[model samples]
Structures are given as structure tokens and as C-alpha cells.
Target: MTTKPAIIILSASVLAMASRVASDLGGEVHGFGKRVPDGADVTFDDVAAHLAGLFQERRPMVAVMAAGAVIRLLAPHLGDKLREPPVVALAEDGSAVVPLLGGHHGANVMARRIAGVVNGFAAITTAGDIRFGVALDQPPEGWALANPGSAKEVMADLVAGASARIEGNAPWLAGSSLSLAEDGEIDLITSDAADAAPGRGLLYRPKRLVLGIGCERGCETGEVLALARESLSEAGLSPQAVGLVASIDVKADEAALHHVARYFDCPVRFFDAARLEAETPRLRNPSDIVFAEVGCHGVAEGAALASVGASGELVAAKRKSGRATCAISRAQQPFTESNLPGRSRGRLFVVGIGPGSDGWRSPEVTQMVSRATDLVGYSLYLDLLGPLANGKTRHDFDLGKEEARVRHAMELAGEGRSVALVCSGDAGIYAMATLVFELLDKADGPDGLRDGARRIEIAVSPGISALQAAAARAGAPLGHDFCTISLSDLLTPWEDIKRRVSAAGEGDFVIAFYNPVSKKRRTQLAWARDKLLEHRPVSCPVILAANLGREGETIRVVPLGELDVDDVDMLTVVVVGSSNSSTVKTGDGRTWVYTPRGYARKEGTAMTNTIPGDAA
Candidate 1:
């Protein structure tokens, strides 16, 4: 079941109260403007527009304000009651709580829950809910409604003293509070796809089936989708009951098989040939030819039984189309992550979190961190993430242990765990990504690494580097040409650093210096400044930015001659301009720095601008 996140909106006056409610309710908080609550994850400008968008997206919302404000903003989007998301309104001081929409679709339940959080009263007005203590249309978790249109009539009959019949083997039917009689006019049937018997009845579908699929290369995806749907319909199975799709690892990239999985809205699992061949003794119709070709007796049936584990049984034998095959299995136990070892492929994500701010962090980095089973980074860098790193296994290392950190992350991934190796700036920019690839190259059979480390899948997610951050702070300093040089000789020799700095000066490139000067290495920045002075004049602009996108940030533009060697530190990025770069003061009395692209020279002679040899 997918639990949609709830959004709590409040004005600045009641931000503290709303923050308390939102925290207790376990959802995201959104404030109107400045002076937002301290715990708000996001802030917005226009309340009406944001609320309407939330309504359209069908996300549950709790508005801590007058009920009229919510209703007026949501009136234009008020269409379907059954499909609409839950909407609740509460008083600022926790007095009254009301369900404004989606009463049957969890609004009433959410209202009561929020009321409990606020120590107030829930105003539930639905008649069936007050009488029967359950919503007829909305089934319990892991249950789907076959036809939602019949819920209203059945609820009406039940509320009007009409007896109901429970005509299925579902255990939930025994605990239902509805008036169930041996023979009654209204029927409630629990089935995979049981049809109506000339009367009003609600069909509740349970998730209990797993579909296994195998397809040839270049097979049409539409054919597999249609055949799978037809087989489910013929077997009296609801598409909603599909738990997963299983296949062999060799067919992991088969398009048709994945398409069928998507149509059923189920996860796809693949088993290696060794695991599949282990199940040959249990095959109903084992083929020697198939075993010889793919090392498996059967792909569909073997994958099905393997995915459902030891207690499951094959309900449908393997059925074939022109270029595809599928089978269905029923599990004795509930489907869960424990039954998902058939698809445990190792993956390692090397990511950069950018500077230490929520605003500067990319969405991809957050998602990678949240999905990772292990996080490996410097101790200080890990501490910057705060609550986002909660509940994950942290492998913190001191600085200068980059090789050990990347190796540990890869070892975890080799054990079939998802690992994220975090860096501060961009991962590819003097970060751990290169070290990961280097370790993989050397892990061939030596260097005391696990044999599986070479096979773990790896990906690099880029982030905003410190040079880009510094350039953005000082407007357009890198507009023409630029090159970055790290002054640290810990990795590279000092002779090479001096050569690169000298080359950058001769080339007249806008130089962005990273790792400018550390505690022990104080002479490199001064040497580079003297070297650059040989090409550009003393009055050239130089922008010094330190701690970009983080606390204690500062940006100062100074003349090249006044470039303070004492002020430069390891955390500072110095961007020195070229000969064409200049500064101008705007109407707001702020200095802006930019390098001209030589278009001004042409603009000054625009009237006489002509191509050479254009005369007759």
C-alpha cells in the first residue's frame, strides 16, 4: 500500500501550534511566508495557489485556519468525492476539527486522528460511519474495491436496516459489524473477481497472486500485456491482486516482461541461473533442451515458485503466447520484503551533497541517501545532514581516509546492500568517484579486497562544486574562460601545481583556486598571485568567496595587488578575473563584476557595420 504524505499549512501567527500538530501527525509542514515555523520543511508565497495545486494532486492536507479559507480555495477543484484526497480543517487553538472532503476515503479517519493529536473533537457527519463504524466503499489495507459505484447503495441498504450476507472465505468478514444474515437482500462478496449475482454487492479484492513472466528478445510488449490481462480475467483473478513479476536474470532487460509488470503495478524480480536450476527437481514438466540452453528447467514456473518461497503453490501452469510465457502462483504467507531475495542486485551510488544547506542539496542526493542501506563519508560531512541521515548505518571516517571510505562502501555493496559514498562538493570534482573506479580496477584478484567487489554496480551523481558556488556569489566572473587548480601537494607534486598555475597565467584564463592555502601550506597562494601578476595588471578584479552556501559565508572583490595571502584558507575559493573583466555600479548602488565578450566594440560601430568587400 502507498501512503501519500500529508501536508500541513498554517499562517505565521499559528506556526508554532501548527508545527506541533504536524509533528504529532507525522507529515510535512508548509508555512505561508517569512517567520515560518522552525520545523517547516518548505515555505510558500501564495496560499490559495498552493492549496489548489495540492487539491489537484490529490494529496491529503490539514489546514490550521478558518474552515471558510480552505473551502473557498478548494471550491474550484471540488469534483469527485470518492477520488479526492483527505481534507481536514482545524482551529488554531485546537478546539474544532472538521472533515471537508473525502469522508469515505480516509478524511473522517484522518480528522479523528488529527483531533486526537490536538486534544479536540472530530466532527464526522457520515451516517454509515456513525452507525456501522466502517466505511463500506473504502476497504481495509491490502484490499481493493472491484466496483466502487455499488458502495453507496450497499451502505444505504445497510443503514436502512437491510440485512447483509457475507459470501466469501475472507477472515475479515467474521469481524465486520454489519448485520449479516443467512439470507439477505444485500451481499458483500470477498473474491479475486467474483461476478454479481443479479443483486447489489461489493467485491473486495485481496492481494494474493504473483505473476511470473518470460519472453523472447524483440517480442511486442502489447502482446504480453494483453495476454497477461486475458489470462487473469479468465482465471477469475483481479489485476489488483498481483503481488510481483518474476523472471530469470538473463531476461532482466526483456521489454515485454517489464511492460507486463508495469501494467500490473508490481515489482519485477529476477533470479540467477544457479538459483533457478536449483528448483529443477520441483518442476512439473522439466525439459532437457531448455535446461541445456538456459541452465533452468523452466523460466516461468521456476521463477514463480522461487519468488513465493517454500510455502507457495503454483495455481496456474505455464501458458505461452507467440513469443512470451507466463504463470501464476499463490502464496500461503503474506507477500513482503522477506520474500524478495530473488532480486537482490548490489548497487553503489557515489553522491555529492553540495554545500551544507538544504536549499543547495539536489533532490537526487536526498533520494540516494534515503534509499541507501549504508552511508560512508567524512564524520563532519555526515554530521551536516542532521536528521536526514537517521536510521541508516553510518560508516564515518576521519578526513584523509578517502581510500578506506570508498573501499568500505564498495564492500557493503558487494554484500548485496545499497551503499552511498557521500562527498561535500561534486563527487567527480576531486572527490571519491575517481577513487572508486581506481579501486575496482585494482580489485581483479589481489590487494585484500572481496572478489565480488569488482562486480558491484556503481553510479556517480553530480553536485554543485565549490567553484560554481563561488562564481555565482560574484556575478559573471567566469563568463569567458576559466580553469581550476588545487594548491594542495598532498596528491600532486608542488612542481606540477606551479607549472599548471604558470600555464593558466600565460593562457590568461580566469583562474579559480581551490584548496588555496592550508595551515602548513601558506606559500602556494602567494606564489600563484605573483605568477598571475606577471600577465594581468595590479588593478584586475579578484573575487574571494569563503564558505559558500553555508554559515559564515563572505564574498569580497579586491584588486589583484591587494589579494591577501593571510585571508585565504582551505575553505576559500579565489576567482581572479582576466584582462577584459571589469566592474560597474548599478542603480541600486551595488557593484557587479563581468567579463566583456567584445560585443561592445561592434555595438559602438553599429551604423557602419558591414562585411568586407561588399561594394559593387
Candidate 2:
């Protein structure tokens, strides 16, 4: 489940309330309708479909609407409560906060939190949380409920005027109004577990255990997980009590460490060498070689001890599996996202925002941009991110300097900050993604790649390209075989570009031209147009789509003989159709340009291509 919530609002009136809630909760606001509201971080038209999609993605939602409306809309998608994320509904005027679903699984708590933001009453319907001041089944972070099935029964009795007494250490639960007494009618059991069943009452496991792991570069995930389980078994410790996974900062990008954290269902924290070195005295098995290599005596033990702070003690000695090590430390208290020090693995998303329109952009790209702590991109592209970059630290650059912009994003991500390198079109298609991979492929010399930048996690999200947006605007102009060529000779030789254009002409392919023209370079588009005309007919359609999917969008279709260079601009993507391509007037008198992939000739040019008696 995503920690960040999506605040969804229907109209412009509730936008103030939505933004206020977003400010307090650190969530992105989604405005639904034709024209996106000014303050919305994201926009969607179809509320039902969008909510279903968000629900399936397991994203926590705070819809600023009636609670009954939300319940009715999501009732069809609701099923097993265990897998659902929190879903809360808020009044349009910010007067009431209600958790419509997932009460025990965080909705109630989220509702209360939202209520605090608006100074409104939390209409928490969950009887347990209302009476006990906590979600009994869903414990707080760094803790787990072993016997969730017993919570309802236990809370029922407690709410029925019965008192309880704890069987083990649970300082975290001291604040909850669970009606406890010295000699209580019921019991609340706690254990540092080893697959043991509860003897009596509701069983809860506090996150007092820390799982520390160290592995060689590119270590197998299974091996690391096996060692963790083995180490836990050896120490007779419960994986449930393992609150956090700790590792050296150098291993921040290690897939094995992340997988082990997933296995324990805990957050992983990375410690710098200096921090780990300070914990050298607490290490059960300090190593000179480790100190020489990573400037730390021991990665596993030091990281574990450092996570638990001054009161922590090593409960399990360093255990090794071929290329990995594991150690356990018991903390005096449980862990949380706030209390845990040291950086987490940095994340870099090379995402394409698509042709300056929310409708054209993918949801994934928007989500990534919202989640990003920093956005690095050219000035115009950064402006295209709209409200998603509202509170983010934008590292904006000029039109040129692509290399510097990407490098800065990597460096920021290496500092454990989530960074998004924004691009206009598809990231992989003649964009900054290639530059990112090239930089990563370089040797890790001092002047080359930095250690932190090299170890950050990077992801590339596909965006609607200029070619796609142009083709879509011109109906099905790219229905047949197509090839794209960038007319700019800055990267490739002009001769090489001409050769590719000539080859595309010979192939009779629908061609999409990127970087067709610029202020200083206007002749390339005319030259390419003439080149394609040599192989295709003079009557062939040439689509000049300027500022596709952006404001003042223009789509001009002209025959090859009448194609004008002056009509195109730097933002234009010129598509030259194949010889077989044609334009036709639809029933509504709307014109469409399409290159048929021989569906007509193969079936004798008849509208019906099926055999006789075949179902239509």
C-alpha cells in the first residue's frame, strides 16, 4: 500500500478544503472534470473509473465528497478487507471526516488525522477504534498483530465494560484506552515470536527487533532472504518483531537488502560509513577488511546497532551465508518512519510527461512526478508538470545543457531524494533516458560517476510521444509500417540522416519526423520533404502537427506538392504518409488520413472480409 494518499475532489468549490487537507497530509489532490481546477495536482474526467483504477493500484484515497457516495461507487470493487488500503471521505465544506472503508486497516486513523487538519469531527464508525483510541487489528508502524482474528472478539468484550492486562512488554500501547487493570477479565499477549500461537487474549508484537544484512554487489535475492530467516531462527526471534532492515549506505541500491525488507515487511534504512564506524565497538564481529573497503568495521552488526540507538544490544552474533551476513539487535522501543535515522535508497524516475496535456499523459508518470522530491528538467518541460511540481524542489535548466540536467538529477537521487528527470515526449525516444544509461555505463572513477549516484534506483516511465500525439490527431496516419527520423544534424551526420530518410522513402513507410525544423535550421524539413517526394507521389499527404496535445494545437494536412516549410515550427512533428495512404470524408464530414495495411486488397477490397455464413 502507498504511504502517500490521493486527495480526490469533484468540483472547484471543495478545492480549498482539498488543498488544506493535502497540505496537512502531504498528499496529491485530484480534480475531476473538464477544465482542471487551478490547485489540483492531478486531473481526471471519469470519477468512477478513476477511483476503480486507484483502488486497484492500492493507493490510499481521501475523496472530498459525501461518504455514502464514495461507498456506493466503491461497493462493487470492495472485497477482502485485508488487502484494501485506506479510503476516507470528507465533507465538501471540510466540516466532517469519515472513513468509508478499511476501518481497521488505517482508514479510521487516516480519517481522524484528516479531521485534525480541518478541525472537524472524525465520524469514525469503527467501534473498536472509537472505544480504544487505536486500530487493534492494524497496529501502528513498527508493530504487528499476530492474532488479528481475535481482535474483534477482544475489543468487543473490552467495549462491553471488560478490562484487560498485558502479558508482556508493550510500552507503545500505554496510551491506548484499552481498559486495562491489574487483575483484568481478559488478557493481551505479546511475544518475541518463533511461530508460536497465542496462549491467551489478543497477541501483538512490538517492533523491538532490528534485522541487519550485508551482501556483496549483485547478490542473489534468495540467498540473502534465506540467511535472514536462518539468522532469525537461530536467535529465536520473530520476523514480525523485526521493525527495520539496516545496511551500509553503499548498499542502498542492493536488491537483496530491499527484498529482505519486504520479507520482514519493514522499512530499510541505510547508514553512512561514518555513522556505522561509530558503532564499531558494538559490533559482534568487526572486520579490518570491511573497514579498509567501506570505512566501517562491520556493515551488518554496526548498522543493526546504530538502528537501535544507545539502548540497543546485539541479540544475535554475525552469521554469514557465502556472500551475505545477518545480525539482529533488540531495541528498547519500536521503530517508525520518523524515528529511524540515516538515508533510504534514493530513487530517480526518468519520466516523459507527454505533449503538455494531462489527457495525453499517463497516470504512472503523474504519480511518479507527485512522489518525486525533486524535479530536474528543461524550463518548458518543468512548466508542463503543472501542479505536480508545486511543492517540489525544481532543478530547472535552459533549452541546451541536457547532460548537466541529468547529472544533477542523479546526484540529487544519490542523496536519497526521489528525483524525476522530466522529458517532453517519450523518455526512451531520442530523450534524456539514453543519456542516463550512458552515464551509468561509465566507469566509477572520481571524475566519472559518484558512489551515491551510481547506487540510486532509477526507473523510466513511457510517455505519449510527439509522433503518437501527431498520428492520433491525424486519425490513423500511422496505420501501416512507419519509421521515425530526427532531422537535427547536431547528434548525427546530415549525410547519415539523409541516407535513413532515403531508405525510409524506398521502404514506402509512413514517416514521422522529429526535430523537423528550428529557428537556425529551417532547410532540413524542406530537404527531407523533397527527398521523400523522389520516391512517393506528389499527391501524398504530409501532416504538419504543431504543438500536439498542447494549447493552440494545429493539424494541417497538405499534399506532397503543396507542403510548405513556413507552416511548420520547432514544435511540429511532420508525418509523410506512404504511397498507398489516403484521406476520406467520414459520415460526419470529418476528414481522416490513414495508411491501410492492405486490409482491402487482401479481401478483394470489399467491406466484408469474412467467408460466407461467418458471424459478423
Steric overlap count per candidate: 0, 0
lDDT of 1 by residue, 249-318 (tens): 7675567876787787666777877787887776676668778878888888888888777788887777
Give a tens-digit lDDT track for model 2, residues 1-616: 2468889998888788788888888887889856455778889989999999899888889998888889888989998889888899898777888887788777887888888888888998888778778777787776788887787787787889998887788765677888889888777777777756554477778887888888999999999999999999998888788888999998998899999888888889999999999998777789999999999999999998998899889999899999999999988878887787678889999999889788888988987887888999999999987887798898989988999988999999999999999999899999999999889988365557788999989899999999998888889987777999999999899999999998998777789999988889989888888887777778888888888887888988899888888888888889998777789888997677998756332211212332222232
All models: lDDT? 0.77, 0.85
Model 1 has a clash total of: 0
Per-prediction TM-score: 0.77, 0.93
Model 1 clashing residue pairs (backbone): none
Q: Which candidate is the best by lDDT?
A: 2
Clashes of 2: 0
- As a whole number from 0 to 100, the lDDT of residue 194 in candidate 2 is 73
Which window of 10 residues has the lowest lDDT sum in candidate 1?
A: 599-608
Q: Report lDDT (Cα) of residue 605, candidate 2.
A: 21
lDDT score, candidate 1, position 455: 56
lDDT of 1 at 130: 83
- Cα error, candidate 2, residue 477 (Å): 0.5
